[model samples]
Target: MKKWLTIALFIFSSSVLFAQKSVKMHPVIDTAKAKWGKIKIVNGTAMTSSNDIVENINLSKDYSLLVTAIEDAGLTQTFKSKGPITFFAPTNQAFSKLPAGEMDTLLKPSHKYDLNYLITYHAIAGKLTVKDIQRKINANKGEATFRTIAGVILTAKIDVNRNIILIDENGGESVISNFDIQQSNGIMHIVSSVLVPKTKVL
Candidate 1:
């Protein structure tokens, strides 16, 4: 009888230990499993691989000019901080179009404020998708005034044939070449021309 009781007790203790192990292991697996659908793995140091805002910008070759301009203007840290900023980033071609030596002059330390103002003038406080702009334009009878973070008001209008155009303070127009480059904190819209704010808009 003693032998039988001892075996039974041993079995019960082993079962309890197994149950505890199972409980702990099960919870770990449950927590480790992703609830969302299968995630695709992105390889390499490309911006499209990550959804992080600053990282994505750093990775993108397309925004090299914009990135250089931002660095030259000393606004890199400012932009990296807590921004769901809408950046109207100009491409390399756009930057090349600047008047002879203008780009070089803007990059100088003395012209830091001018560069900052120009760059920040292109950014808005929130992440505005192209759809949002369209909606706003529709609501405003096909014309909308978008106020930039730099205190400049940009005019968005749809032409008679329905092409979307962004008119600068000087009445020079730039068409949004690429729309909705989404990021974690904001969106980037690639434009053909650099936007310069007018004194009145500033």
Candidate 2:
């Protein structure tokens, strides 16, 4: 009888542990997982293979300039933090689309503050996936405003083509090219353009 009781307790404990492991902490992540179907696995060290944001960024060919700027700005430790940050990373082509010498100017030592603001404007504090963004847009009646670490607001909306567009304070628009690049500490989404925040959105 005691042996049967011990066996039952062990089964109950194992079942409880399994149930806990199966459940996620956030409903948004769960919904995003379902909506997106599967977590994408890439060949390079871009997203799934790497552990942190900087590694993924450094390994990506598209994000070469961005990674260099991040290092120059001295934000490597910040990116390496144990945060579930959501980063709207812009590609090299996006940086190229900037004003003729804007990229060069921002990289200068005197323009570090500007560069930091520019980069931080692309990041949010949480792991907000594509589905979370969609939900926010719907809840806000087609537009959602996200406050960034740079102390600015970025507006987001879904276009008619079902692509998500991020509108910076300066009115520059960036389309989300790749959605949900997961890292150990955060998530990164590739955007087609760089975002610049205005002093205020009028």
Superposed Cα RMSD, model 1:
8.0
After superposing candidate 2 on the true structure, give the runs of residues whose Cα lies further than 4 Å from its correct spot: 1-46, 199-202
TM-scores, each model vs. reference: 0.71, 0.76
Q: By TM-score, how accurate is candidate 1?
A: 0.71
Error of 2 at 139 (Å): 0.7
lDDT of 2: 0.84
Predictions in order: lDDT? 0.75, 0.84
